[model samples]
Target: MTAPLILHYAPDNASLCVRLALEEMRLPYRAVLVDRAKGAQRLPAYLALNPNGLIPVLETPQGPLFETGAILLWLADTQGALMPAPHDPARAHALQWLIWLSNTLHPAQRMLFYPDQYTSGDTGALRATTRQRLITQFDLLENARYANWLDAVTPTAQACYLAPLLRWPALYGGPTDWFDLARWPRLSHFARRFEARPAARRAALAEGLGRTPFSAPTPCNPSEGSAI
Candidate 1:
């Protein structure tokens, strides 16, 4: 007997990537919303699944899993699709970026938007510093000459991960000029292409992110979190 798949998600959370991946793979699963605004993630039941109190805890037949990157890799490997072969060099490359995105880029985003979550003092200066760091990180990615497997006919886990994080920096009420979309033409183009995909659209709609997903390079109207 096959174990069931259940995804605990908050609308517009990093779970967006997992939802998009499932749709891309045509996998069936249930999504349970963990309302952060109402503190559902902190409840004892949810805490049993993920002590981190973060959005997006994926419950698999084996057990509950936290961390978006790990969940994505597991799905891709187990589903035998949406990622390079396990031993392929491309798979290694993909893992490298996934770690960087999850560890560095994701936290930078959290710091920029929710500095208060990390520090008690005034956060204005810290946000500015973090924004610059993010710009530098983006610069590295822009010039890395990395191949976008996501730009393929089928979207990969890496592509799914990139789409949301790229969108948030532009729309998180941070200074627009600090991280302008125009600066990273390659990434901007990548995001636009991802947004145009049917699977991406479905995920966006399912997450209540509205139709015409990623309409413009402006602040996202929906409440979103990157604590994957």
Candidate 2:
């Protein structure tokens, strides 16, 4: 039997994305907590796994894999599930949106969550601007021709990636009053449907994300390690 993959993760962090994907895929894995509250990620031992000290490093038979997007894509490709095969016509479109989640939406979220990192001054202004940008981005996603790719019935890496992105604004984005999932009807529907899945439920329980983790998130009450 193949050895279980090792996931180095912190509760309710980007690691949650990988955890959701793993559960959806029914892949065997072991979860090892990295206590972010203690700055364990910055220590040399964890740095050996991910030099950038990011959350969610998957220790594969090939080696340790970092970056949530790359890890998801690798899992999809290796397992031959959760994404379109390379020769399929839909593969290009799938790759496009996946990269958008990684390069575009995720960075905007980072700015909202940690405005001080993006600018030395006027973090409030930066957050306000990023909030608007996120709204515009969500609007574009709502109307995208490929919006069907985020199907609630069939889990995709994109869906796994997007669910957390959708959840974070409500919990971590400062001054979240301007944000409302209801504004984007399709995404709102997606959130409700996706969070109802068995895989999502298991992930929520493991990570201490309460019911309605995607549709209406609350701060995690993880049994171990802080989100920060």
Candidate 3:
């Protein structure tokens, strides 16, 4: 069978999650670089493929799946292992957190890190305020969601989807004083595991991401965060 083609121009973190799922499952697939950093995803060909112009377009035999969460759910259902079986209570519970990461955690990062992309400059102050509101939601998610990050009983979709958020405040180059990793020890511990996985390392290298700094312990300069 021909491997499905996955066209992704994800800005490092988004690509990371899909790469993790694909590698963990050992599925044969193709990775087409949309290279959003170079404005490739914004081109007409890519826009036609995904109107939102987001990375992570997973082209399966069934059809194309856009959005990372959508693609993840498709993978889990078709392959049914990244997550537990749907009929199982743990599966439904895990599924909720997966959706939460996509809907809640992911959106917060976009607002906090790339407000300019989704909103105008005139709305900068307002966008920043809105991002704070979103951050509260993310903080709530950190506290109440992904409670099983350290359980490791059967790999219920835990922190795999949250690597981006763990790196978010740093990704945008900000004070970690307000966003505490110490508060979520389990996830902080779990995140380190896959972020250093051989497959993850290979994928990051393939995407041209800087090797030494991939798992950033330091924040970027506050003023230097740019839209990708």
Candidate 4:
């Protein structure tokens, strides 16, 4: 028998990517809602699972794992899927893109979504700068060899990571008018195709994402306070 997998997540958070991966893997797992709105993640119990107080912590029999990139890499490596073979040359390229997406692109999105975390006041410039930097990052995908990010029939970890990051600008960036997908046709098409997959479709629906999830705004509630 296999050990059960548990994913501690919050809606519309980076956890969404992990969920997509799990769905793609066709693996059975349980989801634990670390309701950010309820300050659940910051609470003592949840912090015990992930000291960083971040969402998307995967609870395995060995222990709880944190960090989105590490978790994705672990899943690919252990499951022997969603990644190229270790001896394959393409494996190196896949690793490179995954790291860049996690370290570079992911942080940029964070800055745009939660500028207050990085800046004490007047986050306008920070948000603007980060947004532009993000656009350039996507441009690399638009012009790179792996413009599709996948030669395989199904979505990979790279695609899973990219999907949410691509949706970041429209959801959190100041206004829809500021950023345009028309600027990067290749990247736009890639997103459309990835989202069309059955696994992607199921994951999106499970996460309460709409057809135009990129344009879906983050839910706001004055009564519920959450830093995450």
Top candidate on TM-score is 2
Which scores better on TM-score, 3 or 4? 4
TM-score of each: 0.90, 0.97, 0.78, 0.90
Stretches of candidate 4 above 4 Å error?
146-152, 214-228
Residues 4-61, model 2: lDDT tens digits:
7999999889999999999998888999999988999999999999999889899998
Q: Model 1, range 1-228, lDDT digits (tens) per residue?
A: 077689999766788878888888888898887877778889999999999988788888779999999999889889987888878878887888888888998888889988989889879988988988989998888777556663466688888887888777766745766766668887777778888888888787666565544535433344443222
Off by over 4 Å in 2: none
Candidate 1 minimal-lDDT segment of 10 residues: 219-228
- lDDT comparison, 1 vs 3, better candidate: 1
Q: Which candidate number has the best lDDT?
A: 2
Worst 10 residues of 4 by lDDT: 218-227
After best superposition, candidate 1 residue 143: deviation in angstroms?
A: 1.2
User: Cα lDDT for residue 207, model 1?
Assistant: 64
